[model samples]
Each structure stands twice: as C-alpha cells, then as structure tokens.
Target: MALRFAILGAARIAKPALIDPLSENPDASLVAIGASTRERALEYAMTHAIPNAGTYEEVIARDDVDVVYIALPPAGHCEWSLKALEAGKHVFLEKPATVNEAEARVLVDAAKKAGKRLIEAFHYRWHPLFRRAVEIVQSGQLGELVSAEAEFSVPIVRNAREFRWQASQGGGALADLGCYPVSWLRQLTGAEPEVTSAHQDLEPDGIDRRTTAHFSFPNGLQADVICDMDPEGGRKPPRLELVGTKGRLDIDNPLAPQYGAELKLTLDGQETRETFPRRPTFAYQFDGIVDAIQSGQPVWTEGADLIANAAAMAAIRRVAATG
Candidate 1:
C-alpha cells in the first residue's frame, strides 16, 4: 500500500522537499494538507493536488492518512510530532528535530509508545554519496582517522523577517546550518564527540549569525564545524574534509547533492574524483522512509540518532553562550 501522507504546514520547503518527492514516488501519495488556518490549508491543497484540506487536528485524525510530514517552525516541531504519533501516524520531521535534547527524548518516547516511526529529515544522509564516503573512510584505505572538518555558509543579502531569525522559533545559524556539519562529522567519526569549544557572532537581537565549534572524540580524534548564515561574499560551497594517517578525502557540496557533488580522494600522491548522478536529495530521503515503513528496514535518521544530534547541538550552544 502507498504511504498516504498529510502535510502539517504550508512551509516553503514542502514543495521541493516533500510534495515533489511524494508526487514522483509511486509508493507514496500525498493525501491531505493542514495549515495554521483553513484558508491556508485549502490553498495549499488546491495548489498541490492534495485531496483533503483542514486544520492540523482534523487532518491528523483522518483514518486514511498513514504519515505526517511536519514542516512547521522549530518551536512547534516537538509538540506537533507528539500529536502525530499520538494519532497513530508516523512522522517525517524536519531537522533540528526539536529545540533541545529534552524535547527530542519526549518525542522519541512517544513514538515508541505509539509504535510509529519518527525520522529526522536529514535528506543528505539518504544519498549514496555520503554512504560511499563513509565506506571509503571505514574501508581502512584512509588508515586511522586523524581529524575532520565541515563547513556550510551563505551570504546574507539583507536582514529579513523569517521564522529562522526568531529565537523563540528556534532560529539561528547554529540550529539551521550547524546541524548539518555536526551531523556529518558524527557520521564520519562513528562516535559522538564532546564539545571542547565554541564561538559565535551574534546579531543585535542575540541570535547567532555565525558559529564555529570544536569537538573531541574518545579515540583521540578531533573535528571542527563552521556554519555561517551571513557570509561576506557569495555562498561558499559546503565541504567536508577528513584527514587520516594515510590520506585525506574532500567532498564538495555535501549538503545538496541534487545540484551536483564531487568527492576527491588523495592517497599515495594521486587524486581521484568521484561524482554522483544529479538526483534530488529529497527523493532519496522519501524513498528511504517508504522502504523503512514497508520492509522494516532501518531508517538512517532514527529516533536515537535524532536525540543524539539534538544533544550535541545543545552542548554546542551552551559552549557558545559561555564566551
């Protein structure tokens, strides 16, 4: 049976992220749309060819819906995710899974109690490129991993009003862009690292516009993550570099593989570049979720993983606040 999905909000990311993927996938079907207001919901439903439109409660209560794709602000993610699970529906939650680790734990517990899946929508992780990178690192070709660094930055054209800029809504460079590099480092290291230091550039409103964090792993490995929402120049290519005793690997545009990506391995004084097909990251993400629901396959971003990422983010934020 196709996974019947209902969107919880009319977020801008819904189209390229969730709606288009569901439309392209035969195993998934968009059934309904629920927004903060009925008018907004109906507008989105008509625009997206979704059959049902209503309030979030009404949509989640529908017996025909199998899953809920939550695109709400970070502040509302924890509450609505619990509500969806309580409604006996699986959740495809957007990143930063929750504002904090405590909320993440509550959501994870609720999903377990409801016997439903809660996947953090780290779409990049679903792509084969990342998996291949992990394979190369773990294949012993790189030898013992020494250190890793990942960065994501985009120039701020102007100060604009958005949910991402609101502290109450969980808006900050650390929460928005930092999560990706942090998660990527964790994936490469295969172990959660402790935050050793963190620094941030804050706006007048006290929200961080840029952040740099340092982490130390148990195996004497170290990693650095840099995220900047307001860069001076044009958008910097998202990159991850891992250094081992034997060689080093560098990946370009690790965040959005849909545009294009290249992974270069430098070993034995030779450089080799690997490129992946230009498939949207969200498509892979949707397919993975569908497979997990139908075939009992493990989700890449499971509940425990979500909690760990949230905990790491919390630690980073605490360190940033200190100095």
Candidate 2:
C-alpha cells in the first residue's frame, strides 16, 4: 500500500524539493495538506490535487492520514511533530527537529513511547551520490580518511521581511541552510567531530547572516563548513572534498537544489572522474522513508545522530555568542 501522507505545512521549499519527488516516488503518495491559512491550504490542495485540506491538528486526527510531514517553521516543528506522533502517525520532520537539544530529547521520547517513526528531513544524506561517497570512504578504497571540507551558501531572498530573517521563527543562516552541509559532513565523516571552533556573522535581527565552523575528531579526522544567507546575485556552488592517505575525492554541488553532485576520485596516482548523474535528492529521501515505514526499519539519518546534530548546533551558537 502507498504511504498515506498529510503535509502539515505548505512550505515554499516543499514544491521544488519535496512534493515533486513524493509525486514521482512509486511507494509514496501525497494524500493531503493542512495549512494554518485555510485559503492557502485550499489553493494548494486544488493545485496539487491533494484529496483533503484542513487545519494541521485536524489532518493528524484523521484516520486516513497514515503519515505526517511537518514542514513548519523550526520553532513549530517539535510541537506539531510530537502531536502527530501522539496521533499514531509516523512523522517526517523538517531539519533542526527542534530549536534545542532538550526539545529533541522530548520528541524522540514521544516517538519511542508512541511506537512511531520520527525522521529528520535531511534529504542530502539520502542522495545516491553521497551514499556512493560514504561507501568509497568506508571501504578502505580511499585508504584512511584523514580530513574533509564542505561549504553551502547562497544569497538570501532580497527582502528584509523574509521569514529566514526572523529570530523567533528559527530563522538564520545556520538553521535554514548551514544544517545542510553540517549534516553532510557528519554523515561523510561517520563520527560526530568535536566542534572545536565556530564563527558567524550576525544580522541586526539577531539571526546569523553567515557562519563558518570547524570540528575535529579523536581519529584525527577534521572538517570545516561555511554557510551564508546573503550572497551577491550570481551562481555559486557548494564545494565538497575529502583527503585520504592514498587518494582524494572532490564533489561539486554536493547540496544541489536541482541535481545530484559530481564525484571525482584521484587514486593510483592518476586523476579519474565520474559523474553520479543528477536526480532530485528528495526522491531518494522519499524512497528511504517509504522503505522504513514498510519494513519496520529506522531511517538512515537516525534519531541519535539528529540529537547529536542539535547538540553540535547548540554548541556552535554558544561559541558565536561568546565571540
């Protein structure tokens, strides 16, 4: 049976990244949508051909909705996700599952108590390109992984009133965009590198406009990430690199908005290149979530790791505060 999904929010990013893929995935279906704004919700439902539309609470309360995708603002995520779990629905929550670690713990507990699946929507982790990269690194093919570097940034929408510039709504370069590369770094490294140093440029609204972080692991694996919400209006790409004992790999567009990244390998003292082919990242995430829900399995971006990411994010915020 196709997974019956009810989206809790009509997020602007959802159309390009999520809804499109869910529509394409064989195992997933976009069944309904609940928007806080009824007019918008009804319009979205009409345009998308979703079967139902209602308030978020009402959507989860329906027996037909088997799964809930909570794409609300970061501050609203934990509350709605927990509510959905309590309603006996699996939840695919937006990233930064909570504004802080304590909230993440509570949500995880709720999922445990309810016997439901709760997954953070870190879509990049499910991309086949990254999967292949992780396999290569962990297979000893890259010889011993020594270090990695990544960066994700883009100019913010040229409007001061954009939600991303708001503080109370969990708007910031770090939360909205930084988490992308950070999650990728953590996945590629296969360890929670100790966040040794961090820095970020703050907007007057008390949100980060740009930030950079550095982390090191006990195994001598080190990583650095840079994020920016404001950029000059031009095309810029995210950069990914890994250096190992025997060879090195570099991937451009690792967190691409439209396509998968290119994976390049330099080994045998020869430079060879390969393209992983472009596929929407959300498609893979949809596949993973469906497989997990069908097989009674955990999503690859496990809850424990998401909790750790929240802790790391909290620590980074503190470092920024002090500096």
Structural RMSD, model 1: 1.2
- What root-mean-square deviation over C-alphas does model 2 reach? 1.8
What tens digits encode model 2's per-residue C-alpha lDDT throughout 1-323? 98888899888766755688787777778778999877878988898888888888788899988889888889899889888998999998888788888998888889889998988988878876778888888787778778888878888775665777888888898888888777887777777777788998887778898888887876787888788888656446888888989999898887753554578988988887677656777777888888998999877665798788888788788877786
| lDDT, model 1 | 0.89
> Residue pairs in steric clash, candidate 1?
none
Looking at candidate 2, the ten consecutive residues that score lowest on lDDT are: 254-263
Residue-wise lDDT of candidate 1 within 11-114, one digit each (tens)? Answer: 98999889888888899888899999999999988888889999999999999999999999899999899999999999989988999999999999999999
Candidate 1 residue runs with Cα over 4 Å from true position: 156-161
Candidate 2: clashing pairs of residues: 155-231
Instruction: Estimate candidate 2's alpha-carbon lDDT, on a 0 to 1 scale.
Output: 0.82
Best by TM-score: 1
**Tell me, what's the RMSD of every candidate?**
1.2, 1.8
* Global fold similarity of model 1 (TM-score): 0.97
